[model samples]
Target: MRTILAAGALALALGASGIAFAEPVKVGMITTLSGGGAGLGVDARDGFMLAIKLSGSKDIEVVTEDDAMKPELAVQIADKMIQSDKVDVLTGIIWSNLAMAVVPNAVAQGKFYLSVNAGPSPLAGAKCDKNYFNVAYQNDNFHEAAGNYAQTEGIKKMFILAPNYPAGTDSLNGFKRYYKGELVGEVYTKLGQTDYAAEIAQIRASGADSVFFFLPGGMGIAFMKQYAQSGVGIPVMGPGFSFSQDVLAAIGDAALGAKNTASWSPDLDNPKNKEFVEAFKTEYNRLPSIYAAQAFDTGTLLAAAAAKADVKDADAFRAALAAAEFDSVRGKFKFNTNHHPIQDFYVREVVKNDEGVLTNKIVATSFTDHTDAYAAECKL
Candidate 1:
């Protein structure tokens, strides 16, 4: 009698504990966290952590992995997230090629993939899947904004520089689509190469009145420094991802007064951005990167959908996210037909903040209610 009573009491205690804990919602995040791309993943992690804290709920758990800036590594991370962690949703990815590898696997397994950055054009077109949605613009979206700026600014001669890759091609084509400028030169550099002295020399010789450069990470740092020292005296510009607060610490005064196009800025005239910047800076002791903002927005979006009780299953949650109901750091974001953003892109000039931190200030807008090029390719 005593043994039976003890066994029953133990079972009751176990059941109560299980009921109290419930089952935590699992999200898998993969980014380029090694090699030359560690900063991107660090920013993304910070953003998601901030969102998790701000949610004030213990129902969500994120499983994060690093691709080491390699495609095969990304695939391995996807398998781990799906099979080992048993994640219900997938997000995070800083490189276009890496995102391309992970999205298909996540969708094939019928899990939703929320891309915080690295929007590949193929995923927005014929390869479009119902389970994949990008919080970031298509790879060329901001490049098109730069093109529009060049046209509006009456730039006749322009030099284009990008790391030789598919994204480099998109960067050039996207710019030409909007700018009637003479193609002074379109040069491709090594993906992670440092020295830009040769390129700056060529740009000076090309006689271009303006330049568009798409170097990111340390490469962005190197190019910005070189451009400032080159005495080119031309208005250099590109997408905001390469020159925003993330790389400002590295580029310092070299990025000052430099212009770029983006859909978000820390100082935008919106309450959401105001709250995010303050919270992020106070917690992290550094300016939030655009990647960080996008990741935070993704977390809130997914959590809100879950809180609305839409994610009893994965499909319902994806539909809710596709509706674009979440108030994002990029204010007033709506979806294009291709499931990419139709947000406004602004011309941002790098400037110092009140706390002596470098940041971007909006000077003008490039596109209003602008959509991606692949929307026509998507049947929806």
Candidate 2:
């Protein structure tokens, strides 16, 4: 009887602990891991893996695939993750179009979709899903910040440029919403276009006091290098995608003193941010960009939420995710009603670090506790 009582007590204790003894939680990451935009995806993947490692959870398994910046490929990968791999959570698509293609379908299937990078307005607004959460800012947040900064600086005329895509359209529209300035020119370049000689000539004649362009990864590097050589002599500004740490080395002196808007920076003053920055540099041997920072936050957030509730229980897991109890590299992190972050955006200037590597330094706060314009459209 004593032996049986002791065994029973042990079983009760084990049950009370609520330790997850179930199968590992599967997570699928589909992002632009190759081609021109590989740098952003690589940084995001590295940062995410680092967070998962730091979490020290043995029950999480991540499956990653290269989307190659193709929307159809991302959709295919999403289907595989859902149907074959049976991932409990899906995350990490870098482009707005790819996110649009995959997020809705994945969420509709009752799988939780956590966005690490792309936060298109449609997901944030009318089509907001209870199973969808954006760990990054909405697509327009950084661009809108740029516009606000331009308005504050009294720039009367600005030239805007972005690739002709969903994100590009949203970026320019966001900028226009807050700029309160006359547009000297609004040009949509072909996606992945390398040469900007024609565009630079037009900008030179546009008589714009400033230029704002949203070209990410290699596109930004190519444009900045050519624009610098063209001697347009106009102050350049844009969303941080064009001036992130991942591409700054390639951009070099051309990006120096250029300002951009972002929701996260390595120089953000907080314990979580400091730890993240040091760990990232130590692990990756490079400075972490906003892209990496957001990805890291996504991983940490998932770990925290998973710890609180089982991923198999969708409602419980969603509730835990909504709580957002993890410490974020971005100082004060919270989700708006639409599951997008309501956080501070800052103006960053490209400057050489002590080691002479080009990196962004925070110069000013562009927006404080800002929420996206689409939240009003979200029923949830």
Highest lDDT among the candidates is held by which one? Answer: 2
- RMSD, every candidate, angstroms: 3.6, 2.1
Clash count for candidate 1 is 0
Error at 354, model 1, angstroms:
1.9
Per-residue CA lDDT of model 1 for 1-380, tens digit only, reads: 99999999988888676534345678888886777788988898889878878877678888888888888988988998889898888888888898888898789888888888888889999888888888878888899999999999998899999999898888888888999879899999998889999999999899998889988889999998888888878878989877867789889887888899988888789888888888998999888988898888888777766665434466667778788887788889877777788888999999988878888999999999888888888886
Off by over 4 Å in 1: 1-23, 310-312
Residue 362 in candidate 1, Cα distance off native in Å:
0.6
Residue pair clashes in candidate 1: none
Write down the lDDT of every candidate, Cα atoms only.
0.85, 0.93
How far does residue 177 in candidate 1 sit from its true spot (Å)? 1.1
Which sections of candidate 2 miss by over 4 Å? 1-13, 20-23
Per-residue CA lDDT of model 2 for 1-380, tens digit only, reads 99999999998888777855645779999988898788889989999999999899888899999999999999999999999999999998988889999999999999999999999998999999999999998999999999999999999999999999888999999999899889999999998899999999999999999999999988898999999999789999999999999889989899999999999888899999999999999998889988899999999999988888889888888999999999999999999999999899999999998999899899999999999999999999
